[model samples]
Target: AARIIVIQKRAAGKKWGKIMVQWHPLLTTSIPVEQPKGQGIKDLWEDIRLPGEGYYFREQRFGNPGQTSMKLTERVIIAFSNPDDVILDPFLGSGTTAVACKRLNRHYIGFEISPEYCKIAKARLLAEKTLWD
Candidate 1:
């Protein structure tokens, strides 16, 4: 589900308590699969391979899963959003949104549920300069 909200400058550190979501787009593909009658294993995915560091950030500079691959994020942001546009990711994770925004000239704001993730996000954002420059 994806929802885009366009807003003029928002107050700093002020959280919008509750938001009423209007639309939710289905995120699954149209692949037919059967489910068991009882509580059992569900084959939601046909193949599963444990991801390595490359899967997350593609760099060992920071050994963290929360930080996504900068290249991957940059590609997605460039594809979906444009420069100077407001992009929001409720689950910010490791500040991937911020890094991509910085590189693409877009404005982004997001929140991380875990303080650890937040720290990781901060580190990831800080590390962007070194990676890009």
Candidate 2:
């Protein structure tokens, strides 16, 4: 299994100014257990399987509870880009783009809306050990 470090915090007080942090591996990627090809063209996605074993993790994302993590977004970036390549995500929900880039060996910049989500995104990126090394 591949390990990922997780950092969590709670917004405190009425202003939510105080935050405490804890670090650990909240999740790990297991070796893909199965292979399946769902409908339509597979796009540029190779490691991401569609509605089966390899695809099972898609649902863990922020908006799509059953879809997958922004981590998959990292895999896509890695497949298409080189280290230090500039990758951008216009709607950077949950900072998935930045987090994934940290893991996939790329340089990325993104924009996200929610302040809380930004915290999570930043935490995710900061916790990552650069895949480049």
Candidate 3:
């Protein structure tokens, strides 16, 4: 449906990087003012040439073999989009994209080829700790 695609390096030695995002209809990326002091989303793509750390779950990361790092995904989502924006992930691996979207208050539609991965991703999303008290 929608499309908000982001291509990133898998790692330093890896021959190929990963195409991580895909949005629906049409999505626009805008740089906003009033950010966290010196740090702004403007610098989000500054180090795009480097390798992504992949998911933060480490040993806990399962189901999908190619899980993008949570921090990297979150950073991209925060920079390229705003809260309430919709994200589309065609290859919904470990659901890192969905997790990032949820944490950032963005809507998402994730598609996965494997039902097993889907279930695993769902559990991970539900297991996420809320920011609210």
Candidate 4:
């Protein structure tokens, strides 16, 4: 069963939304089998708040303009993948996705175009790794 989750965000006086598609891929056979019973994620999520300018703001501390919520990323990772699954993140930004993947025991391949952001991501990833060690 595939599900599409829509996340709406309003920042900098502009309204934008992101769509997350979740589906189980059949790696062995073409025939689809019954998926394991589990709680379903709602199509619309409104609880997670975006990071903003505040004294306590931490998600965007790396200065990534497009940074997202860590809770939101972890929820998506938990809903769509299992332990040891490989996740590809084209735009790593501050490495939120990779950090979440590490916390969830999933492997991740992240790419960041900016050298500064890459350093930030590596630092974050290392911090996350140290927590588990």
Best candidate (score: lDDT) = 4
How much is 47 displaced in model 3, in angstroms? 7.2
User: Better model by TM-score, 2 or 4?
Assistant: 4
Q: Top TM-score: which candidate number?
A: 4
Candidate 3, residues 1-133, lDDT tens digits: the string is 3334344444433334665432112143554434566665443243433244432344356756677567667766766677888989999987989988988899999999888898988998999776872
TM-score of decoy 3? 0.59
Task: Name the 10 consecutive residues with the lowest summed lDDT in model 2.
Answer: 5-14
Q: Candidate 4 lDDT, tens digit per residue, 1-133?
A: 4445555443433334744332212121122222358445555666654443332245446787677678878867776677888989999998999999999899999988999999999988887753549
Candidate 3: stretches off by over 4 Å: 1-59
Q: Kindly list the per-residue Cα lDDT of model 2 for residues 7-102, writing each as its tens digit.
A: 322222243454433222334343322223533322233333333322234244554233235645554464446677788887776676777777
Please give the RMSD to the true structure for each candidate, in Å: 15.8, 15.0, 7.2, 7.5
Each candidate's lDDT (Cα)?
0.54, 0.52, 0.65, 0.68
| Model 2 accuracy (lDDT, Cα) | 0.52
Best-first order by lDDT = 4, 3, 1, 2
lDDT of 3 at 38: 66
Q: Which stretches of candidate 4 lie over 4 Å from their true place?
A: 1-3, 8-37, 51-60, 130-132
| TM-score, per-candidate, Cα-based | 0.49, 0.49, 0.59, 0.67
- Tell me the number of clashing residue pairs for each predicted model: 0, 6, 12, 0
